[model samples]
Target: MAHRMTPPSRLLASVGLAAALAFGATACGDTSSDGPNGAADITIVTGFYPAQFLADSLLGDSGTNVDVVNLTPPGAEPHHLELTPDDVIRLAEADLVITLDGFQHAVDEAIEEARPAAVIDLAPAADLTTKAGSDGLDYHFWLDTTRYGRVASTLAERLTELIPAEADAIAANLATLLTTLDAVDTAYRDGLAACEQELIVTGHTAFGYLAQRYGLVERGIAGLEPEDEPSANALADLATLVNDNGVTTIFFETLTSPDIAKTLAAETGANTNVLDPIEGVSNDSRGGDYVAIMNSNLEALRAGLRCG
Candidate 1:
């Protein structure tokens, strides 16, 4: 179905608290103010960085054709994204909303309350798989370029269907995006093909998809969620793996605490390095966008893993 939004009750449901909004006016038959063929503007609300990147690429300089709002701000941790009432209303009023559910509980709750006309959950398109042989699905599928591309395809198709007037432009954008993703996949394949150490450990289990994709083994100090504290047993086991495998680097990510990884590195006589998960973008990020950050991560891996 083409995306449309009737003025939501303008009420945000937040853990038993409520914020109500009243819209004095509504656009005539369209949520977008104006665009191609006199079609209304399209608004897209993204859950986080990965979703925002795809939406930005899909729009592809279709300036004013579409507006994208990301709930998770740059430099903030997506795992702890706290949404304002205004954020919920934006989601409710957006023509389309794209997100990976369960990754952020607050965003998930907002989506349910906002009830956007069109919502694309990237999880299904991603075909999420478990990591470390655990029963829970790893939500960091974007770290795998192949999985990211699949979600991109889904978004392009949905957006085109929702806004036929912009289909041609969107298709062109998708082609370019697919090409970029393919190139990224190739780089990872070639970069990690051979390494001094295949046991790439990180601050968290965020790199399971990337490690699996490239046939590199990944172990994390934290569990799937960055905030999960590893038990003494888990830390000891990881230290053993580090020593036994002669691992030279202990990797940490941009958006989370580095103390644990740094501490482990000190304990194990390994160097601390960044292996970003690309969940959000900020000045501190090695690269400004997804592709650049992925390339930076590749360099980090190559250097840390001592890849030839």
Candidate 2:
């Protein structure tokens, strides 16, 4: 019998407390206020790095004074990230906060308490009950470029509203953003359109929408939670899938343990490689950002999926 797993809240709390101690405390404060002469200080607390990247891009380098920070540590489960007391203070004082619903449970709690002036819940406010596009309750929306565009648009609008003077610039910025995203979409479409392999087997099920958009089948070792290990039956089934589909590559995420993937690759005699879901960048991410990570994933997919 498969054992039922606990949700990530407990896990996040445990990790968060430890990380808070290790990293000590760092709070992002905006000294410049909404005074007559100064621009409002903007600090965005994101659940992950991709969200932070999008925030930075939308806020722009000039006109908008924004500081973006990731709440999840490197190799941590995003769904389980809990906010420290310091994190709560950051959320309470921020001019605006963006959340991808269940992605940051701890941050959500703080938001409820703080009730900031502007809160953009990326969960569509309309469908909190339904699971995110795919993989069942997976909150990693940034991986899906299509859904990501919607969230990016919302972020752009919210940032514009927060800093009304930058509205025109924000519009232009969003236009540029849309164009870039379109290019990404085209890249995937063209790259994977006529692939010999239609199935993408990965460590975590983060590419639900990406696979859907490119018309590829996604088979994951674990469910939504990256830390969750598959059952014995699940592994056996996955092995069968690999053999049947003639799968030559097994993808693993950068932020999770690759042991299972390594074992599978050895058993199936398939090649193994890192296919980043871009959850969050560790301090040692080598200054990698959103575009760099996603573009890397695109290239890896093309090579691994044998889509030449």
Best by TM-score: 1
Over 103-171, each residue of candidate 2 has an lDDT whose tens digit, in order, gives: 666787766655555678878822333234454575666777767788788788788777888888878
Quick one: best lDDT, which candidate?
A: 1
List candidate 1 stretches off by more than 4 Å.
1-40
lDDT of each: 0.82, 0.71
Candidate 2 least-lDDT 10 residues:
1-10
Please give the RMSD of candidate 1 to the true structure. 4.6
Candidate 1's TM-score reads 0.88
Clash pairs for candidate 1: 32-41
Off by over 4 Å in 2: 1-40, 125-135, 283-287
Number of clashes found in candidate 1: 1
lDDT of 1 by residue, 211-244 (tens): 8889898888888888888988888888888999
Positional deviation of residue 11's Cα in model 1 after best superposition, in angstroms: 4.8
